[model samples]
Every structure is written in C-alpha cells, then in structure tokens.
Target chain A: MNKIILLNNRPTGKPQASDFKFTDENKPEIAKGEILLKTKFVSVDPYLRGRMSNAESYVEPFKLNKPISSGCIAEVVESKNESFKKGDFVSGSLDWKEYQVSNGKGLLTIDASIAPLSTYLGILGMTGLTAYLGLTEIGVPKKGETIVVSGAAGAVGSVVGQIGKILGCHVVGIAGTDEKVAMLKSKFGFDDAINYNTTKDIKKAIATACPNGIDVYFDNVGGDISDNVHANINRFGRIIVCGAISAYNETSVPTGPRVEHFLIRKSVLMQGFIIGNYVEKFPEGIKQLSKWLQEGKLTYTETIVEGFDTIPQAFMDLFEGKNTGKMIVKI
Target chain B: MNKIILLNNRPTGKPQASDFKFTDENKPEIAKGEILLKTKFVSVDPYLRGRMSNAESYVEPFKLNKPISSGCIAEVVESKNESFKKGDFVSGSLDWKEYQVSNGKGLLTIDASIAPLSTYLGILGMTGLTAYLGLTEIGVPKKGETIVVSGAAGAVGSVVGQIGKILGCHVVGIAGTDEKVAMLKSKFGFDDAINYNTTKDIKKAIATACPNGIDVYFDNVGGDISDNVHANINRFGRIIVCGAISAYNETSVPTGPRVEHFLIRKSVLMQGFIIGNYVEKFPEGIKQLSKWLQEGKLTYTETIVEGFDTIPQAFMDLFEGKNTGKMIVKI
Candidate 1:
C-alpha cells in the first residue's frame, strides 16, 4: 500500500492541518523506461503556500483532492530505465507518498558522498541556486556596500547574507526571532541582525544597522518590512524581490507604501525575478555554491520533521516562521 | 540694470505668484575667460518643483530669497573668453534675470539655423535627452512590444511615445485632457491615446487600450494613474520612473497600491533616473535626437509665456496639466 496526502481545502489565512487529507492507495506500477522510487525526504518551502490558493501565480495552484507535491529525495527500488538503477539515490518533484512511479524524465541522480541526501533538496539544490542567482544577478552587491536581507533566518535569505559577506559587503539581516538573529550573526557571519518581531520601529532599526544606507536589498518578506528597507536604500541601490512570505496567506490583495518617488529620487533599481529565470546559469551557480561549500566558506541548517504525517504541519510552519532554515519532512 | 525673480517664500502645496518676488539688480560684469549673457528663453520644467522644497534630493534645494535658476538660452552680449563671441546664441543654467555673467565653461553655442532657439530649451536639450536615455536605457522597448506612456503630452513623455513608434512598438499615451489625448494620437503618432481625466476606471481602460498588455511604461505621472498602469503590465515588464508630476504639489507624502508582489510574479524591472546621470552619453543621445529631427521623424510643441514676470505662472501651470508640451518663458 502507498500512503499519500491530498489538498482538502483552500486556506483563507493561516493554513490548518485539516486542509490536507491523508489516504492509502495501491502502489503505482513502473513501466518500461520508468523507475519506482521510495521516498526518503520531502521539501516543505514557503513557495508551496502560494500553490495552495486558487490564484494566478508563477506556478499553477494545487487542485483540491489532488496529491500535494514538491521536491523530494528518493531511492530507486526498481528501474526499467538505463539512466537509473536499483539502490541509486535520486531527486525530483514527487508527491507526499511512501512510493512513487517516475519515467526518470526530470529526476537527477544524487551522489551521497558530496553531502547528505536531504541537503540536495536544500542548500545544494533550488534553495542555494535561488540565493546565488537573485543576489548576484539582481542585487549586484559591491565590496564595502551595505546589503540588507529580510526573512534572514529562512532557507534562501540565510544563503544570500552569507554570499554578501563573502563578496566583502556589510550584511544586515532582519528575522522574526532573537534566536534566529543570533544564528544569523554568530553562524552566518551577518554583520548585524535585527529581530523584526520585537522591534518597535523597523525603519529606525534598519537605519541603525545600515549607517551608510542599504546598497543591495534581498527581500523575502514584503510589506512593512520592505517599506522600511526601501526608505533606507542608498542612491543607485538595487532591490531583488525574491518572495513576499508576509503577504502570501492574506485573503485579500496586500497593499503597502508606494515606492515610485523613493526609487526616482534615489535613482534606484528594483527587479523581481524567480530562480527559474536564470536556468541557463544554474550550472555556473551550482558550481560556485558547491565550491564555496567545499572551501568551508558556506554553511546551512535544517529543521527535519520525521514521519510522512508531519508534512502538512512542517509546511504550515513556514508561514509561522517556525523553521530557522530549510524545513524538511523525513520519511 | 538686470531684473531678476527671487524666491519670496517656500510653497507648502501648490505654488502661487506671491511665492516669487521681482527685483532689480546691477548688471553682472564678465571677467577674463567669461561671457556676459542676455537671457532670451528660460525653461520652466516640472523638476524645478523638487528644487523649490527644502528636502534632500539629487539636486540641492533653492536657497531662500535667492534668484530662481533653470536652463536658459541666452545671447552673448560681451565675451571675455576665446571660445565665445558677442552675438553668439548659447544655452546653459542661468538665473531668472535679464542679464547673467557666465564663465563660458558650461555654455554650449547653439546654431539657430538648425532649430529654433526655444527648441534648444526643449527638444534639442535636456528634455529630449531625458526621453532618449530613460526610454532606451531603462524602458528597453522591443519591436512589436506595447509601450504605455503616462503624461504623454508632456515634454519627456511625448518624445518617449514617438521613440516607441520609431522602434516599431505599439504605443499608447495617457494624458489629462481630451485635446492632449487627440494631439498624442493625431500629431505625435501614438497608436492609442486615453484621457485619464475623464476615464472612470483607469485599470480597465489600460487593459482595453493595451490588449496585449504593457511591455514598457514611461511613467511621468505617479499616483493612481501609475498604479493602474502597473496592474496591466505584462511579464518581464519595464517601468521607467521619469517624474511624478501628479505628486509634486501634495502637502504630505502620497500613497498608492504597492507593486512588489506584482513585480515578483511577473519578473518586472523598475528603474528611476535623472538625465544628468547619463552625462557621459550625451553626445550619443543628441546625435540620435538630431537625426530624428532632421528626418522629420520627431516633432515637438511648446507653450511660450512672454515676459519674465510670467515665469512663476508658467511653472505652476505644469502641476495643473495646462501645458501641452514644453512650457517656456521668453524674457
């Protein structure tokens, strides 16, 4: 028997566990040129929350009563494909189930000796590529310039701040908790970190952190936090709009301060892009990220929730900012 | 004797005639390597409003009780420099006075036979350079793309729309009056024109006009009109923030719909710039503009207010959308 989870309901605000349903189904059969994979780990990212709603987005919305899916690390138990073989570890988009059938089309074989299998879904995977591409391509941080990152404790933002430091920039991060702030400074080497949740005036806090003003802004949390950051941006600044996790779960369209005057006055540039836009440069990005990791210039952390039943809870935790880094469900 | 206009008081909202005071002063004398210039035509632009305030901006604010200065076309009455001779027509920044003393360093001799002297204050000058640089650099319009321009009847916006047409793009113009809208379509060769003043729903109007969606936006009006234009932008849209005439007179900071999520979802790029930033590329811009003028591909209009006393009134008319194109004060 194969157990899978389906999206049962659309969430209005914060998602509830009841929005997902767990059920059992017959194991899928792998035909010729196909591989049968046993699930090892499932990635629960903030972007998944956007798929839960029936709204037009970069990706299609998740259909009701359909198996919810995301990035997953799996082991091939059986393979009819010459590209993959039994006992080989692979990574691909897969449903939240114990077993799945794949044609090995989008699946990539993973080398366990490079790093842990779960990290392939995180630091060495889409998360790392997102941070590297968005920061370098859009933000374009220069040496001695101040780089500010919002949602600093999250998977992508943590890497962005670390890369900013590596490029000889003064990095400042805004996270939700004091613990996350401490992690950003102590572990990630962020020059300064502010706990946005406890700060009375975010604008003042940002001003204090960035004495010379923000030259590059890697925005993961949009809303008031972004407004504050925009207010403190330097002349010829760059703002890379990565994600707006703060407004993702809102029932209505979110609104905040307009930035036209700010941008015009400062001669700033604000660009919004997804990692997929840089697909042609992924090999370059992965090569650099891997090199940095090997040289011990980069580090990452993960919050692993064991058991297939914890997938929904782990995903919902993203909206609550409960995970310090990449959130994963280990089966 | 030299008659000049000085700033009587800083304006809180919309400026008034009383904000300027006319005074008489002794004629300035030209020293060695300098020229004594008799003012001919003064350029009254919307950007001047930003300099009237005590706020920090790209250019320093005008000092209290000092003569207001702007781009002016003048005749060299006496020359002490080898580069300039008496009776030569030149353009440069000059105080709002009948006569000015210049070091001939920043002055550029203009050939009146090439274009009208007043046009040197408009089409062949800063206004034309603004349109060329902002459109080509930031807007980056492609052939077959749809370009929407706000304040389309104004100096910079008019040129931007015409350039879009020359680039084989579908051009749409948004103006404040029906007459201006008609001029944009009939005279300026814009493919479509909308009267934003009479439109009930700007968003729906933009959607109707730009059926294919806006690929590039040359924004001069930055309030609800811009918010509507931003909503109708296509994927990978580009917004060139040139000016914010709509908010220039607002007593408090203006607020409108936020665009971070919109930019993120569509992978849009928004950039703000002043023409001065492209000083190094002026020769390139002027060559293109001069070629278009000579080829009869570009035409410009100006509303000339005779007499030096009318300078303040002409400037105030910009905020009211009373000028069709460049507003000039002939002194």
Candidate 2:
C-alpha cells in the first residue's frame, strides 16, 4: 500500500486543504520498459498553482481523482529495463505518493554519494536548471553589469542571483522580507538586496542599489517590481522572464506596469525562458553545473517539510512567501 | 530671410496649429566650421510628438520657444569648412525651418542624383534604417517564417513588411484602413493584410491570416492591436517595437491586454529600437539598404506634403495615421 494525494476538484483561487485528499493505493506493477520508484522528495513549485486550475497552459492540467505530478527525486526499487536497477536514485516526472512507475522517459539517474537526494529536487534538478538556463541563455549577462532579480529568496531567484555573482556581474535581489534580503546577501553573495515590502519607492531603491541602472533583470515576480525595473533599465538591457509568482494566484487580472515606451526608449530586450524547453541541451548544462558545484563556485539551499500529507501546505506556502529557498516535501 | 516654426508651448495632448507659430527670421550666418543649407525635405514622424512633451525620454525633449528638430535633407549654399561646397546635398539634424546654418559635424553629404532628395527622408534615410534594424537586428526573421507588421501602410511598418517578403518570409500587414490594407498587399507585396479597424476579433483575424501564428512581429501601433498580436505569438516569437503611434498622444495610461503572462508562456522576445543609437553601425546598415534599393530588391513610396508652411499639419497628420508611406514635407 502506498499513500497518495489525489486532486478532488479544480481550484478557483487559493487551493484549500480539501482540494487534495490523501489516500492509500495498491502500487506494485512494473510493466515492460517501466521502473518502480519510491519518492524521496516531492517538489512543490509555484507553477503547480497553474496546473491546479484548468486553464490553457504549457502542460495539461491535473485531472480529478488523480495524484499530482512534479519533478520528484526518487529511488528506483525495481526495474524491467536495462537503464535502471534496484537502489538507483532517479529524478523526473513522478506522483506525490510513496512509489510510482516511469517508462524510462523524463527520468534522470543521480549518484547518491555525490550529493544528498533532496539536493537533486532543488539545486541539481529543475529549479537550478531554471535559474542556470535563464541567466546564461536568456539573461546573457556581461561582466561588471548589474542584474536585478525579483523573488530573490525563492528557489530560482536565489540560484539566479548566485549565478549572476559567479559570472562577475553585480547582483541586486528583491525579496518580500528582511530575512530573505539578508539571506540573499549573506548566503547567496548578492551585491545588494532590497525588501520590497519595506521599500516605498521601488524604482529609487533599485536606482540606489544599481547606480548605473540595471543591465539584466531576471523577473521571477512580475507586477509592480517588474515595472520598477523596466523604468530603470539601461540602453540595450536584457530582461529575462522566468516566472510571475505575484500574478499566478490572482483570481482577476492585476494592473501591471505600462511599459511600451520604456522598451522603445531603452531598446531593451525582454525574453521569457523555461527550463524544460532546453531538454536536448540538458547534458551539457548539467555537466557545467556539476563542475561549478564541485569547484564551490555554486551552492544551493532547500526548505524541506516532512511527510507526504504536508504537500498541500508546502504548495500553499510558496504563494505566501513562507519558504526561504526551494520548497520541497521529503517523503 | 527664412521661415521657421517655433515651439510656442508644450502640448497637453494631440498637438494643434496653435502649439507652433510660424515666423520669419534672418538667415543664419555660416560660422568658422559651419555650413549654410536650404531645407529640401523634412521628416514628419511620430517620435516628434514625444519630443514636444516635457518628459524624461531617451532623446531630449524639445525646449519651449525653440523650433522642433528632425532629420532633414538640405542643399548646401555656403560652406566655411573644406569638406563641403556649394550645390552639395546634405542630410543632418536640422529643424522645421526653410534655411539654416549648422556645424558640419553631424551632417552627411548625399548625392541626390543617385536617388530623389525626398528618398533621403524616407526609404534611403532614417525610416529605412529604422525598418532594417528593427527587422534584422531586433525581429531576427528566419527564412520561410511568417512576419506580421502593424501600421503596415505607414513609413517604417511598410518597409519592415517589404523586407520580410524579400527575406522569403510570408508577411502579414495590419493597417488602419481597407485602402491601406489593399496597398500593403499590392504595393508592398505582403502575403496578407488586415485592416484592424474593420476586424471584429483581432486575435481570430490574425489567426486566420497567419495560420502558423506570428513568428516575428514588427509593432508600430502599440495598443489593443499589439495585445492581439501578442496573444497569438508563436513559441519563441520575436517582437520588435519600432514605434507606438497609437499611444503617442495618450495623456493617461492606455488600457489594453495584459502582457506579463505572454513573456512566460511563449518565451517571446520584445525589444524596442531607435535608429540614432546604432550610429556606430549606421553606415553598414545604409550600405545594405542602399544595395537592396539599387538591386531592385527593395521598393519605396513617399507621401509628400508640399510647402514648408504645411510642416505642422504634416506632423499632426501622422497622429491620425494619414500618410501612406514615409511622411515628408517638401520645402
């Protein structure tokens, strides 16, 4: 018997605890080219909110009475294919349950001795890749340039700021709280950090932090913060849109910044990027990221909640800006 | 004596005739390093409206009681510098004036025999450079791909659409009137043309015209039309923001479709471009544009408004989308 959390109904706004129901299910089947995996950590990202509501999106919405799926780090218990065997750790699209099956695709094998299993769910997995590709490919940072990041304490933003620092650019991070701001400077080595909740004039705050104006902006929380950054972007600046956590939960359309003139005057390049879209380039990216980790040039932190029953709370916490780093639920 | 229009006051909204006053003044003397020239053609563009307002922009706003300046083609009558002589055709940053004396630093000598003097104000000049840079550098069109251009019958937009067709891409043009739409297909050689004013559902109209969705969008009129194009932008689409004639006269923020989400889903690249900033590479751009014209790969049209006294109305007419191609005032 395996414990699984199944979607009861499509959520309208903020998902309630009743929206997901925890139940026991029989799971022991391994068909041809399939492997049975035990969940070590179930990742909860803000994008899951989009999946909770049935809307036109990049991926299909989760159906009712089915377990929610995400990038989970799991241990291969049994295998029917040559790719994996018993005791091999893998990470890919998996269910929020004790064990599930994957048919060799979208699954990644990880070495347990190299890093902790939960690290794969946060740093070495999708979250880190989101930051890596977004910064290097989309952000296209230059040496000595300033890169501003919103939602700086979150998984992707934190990694982005750290990577910006590693790439020799001045990194300014904007978060919701004082603690997150402190974490950005102290833990991530960002040049400057701003608590947006405390700042009255965000544009002034960004200008004060970045005297020369922003060169690259990795937008994770796009609302007024994006507008503030848009106002101060330098000529030929690059803006990378990774996510918009601020607007994802809204039941209605939020008033965003009127930015057309700013784009024209500055000739800024604003590009959006998703990590999954770069699957073919994953091996090269992962190899470089692994080397950066081994060289101590890169570091990551994950906030873990124990038990599968805490998945709903873990996901809910993402919207409230509760977690400091990548929010992961250890099963 | 020379006739010139001086900026009497800053415009509150769409500029009227009262905002400028025509006056006769003594012809400016040629200084030690200056040249005296007679204005031949003056460019009346949408960007001039932005220059009239006292706002912080990429270019310095026009001062009150000063004649508004724009790109103009002139004939040199007197020269104190050795580089220029009488009867030489020159293009430079002059004002809405009949005759002016200027330093030779910013002026470029031109051969009117190669192309018409008005062509220097339109296809062979700033409008051409704007379209070239906006499409090649910003839009980055791929061969066999589809490109959609807004304000398609206007100066920059028409050239951009024609360049798209020349690049072997199917070009869809969106203009204001049915006549303009017909002209876009017939004169500009566009694959399809849409009169956005007549189209009930712009998204559906664009979808019907471009079954593959717009891969490269050269946006000139930025409002609901831009929003409609953005909603249907293909994955990895590039949008080049050359001008926003629709929003130039707007006193308050324009209300339309929200775009922060589009940045996330499509990984779209929206950039603004100005020709002056690319001065370092302008010669190269001009050479290519000139070669295209000489080879008959490029065709150009001009909406010539005769008389120096008609400059104010020529400029005002741009706000109403009155011009078919490049709006030039023949002095």
Best lDDT goes to which candidate? 1
RMSD, candidate 1, Å? 1.3
**A217-310: candidate 1 lDDT, tens digit per residue:** 9999899899999989999999999999988888876777668888888999999979878889988998899999999999999999999989
- Model 2 agreement with the true structure over B1-331: per-residue lDDT tens digits: 8898999988877999999988989988877877889999888889989889887778999998888899999999998989999999999889888888888878889988888888888888889989998799878899989999999998888889889988899899999899999888888899999988889998899999998888999988888888888878888899888888888888865665457677777778888888878888788878988999999888887889899999999999988878889998888
Please tell me how candidate 1 rates in CAPRI terms: medium
lDDT against the true structure, per candidate, is 0.91, 0.86
Tens-digit per-residue lDDT, B1-331, candidate 1:
7898999988989998888999998988878988899999999998888889998788989998999999999999999999999999999888999998888878899999998999888888999999989999998889999999999999888998899999999999999888999999989999999998899998999999999999999999888899899889998999999998888888777877678788888899999978989999888988899999999999998988899878999998888888888899898
Which number leads on DockQ? 1
Candidate 2 residue-wise lDDT at A86: 91
Error of 1 at A35 (Å): 1.0
lDDT string for model 2 (A1-331, tens) is 8888899877767778889988997987999988898888889998888888777667789989998998888888899989999999888888888988888787878899987888787778787888888888877899899999998889888989988988899999999999888888888999999998999998999999999899999999888888888878898898888888888878866665456787887878888787878888777777877888889988887888998889999998888888978899988
Off-target runs (Cα >4 Å) in candidate 1 are: none
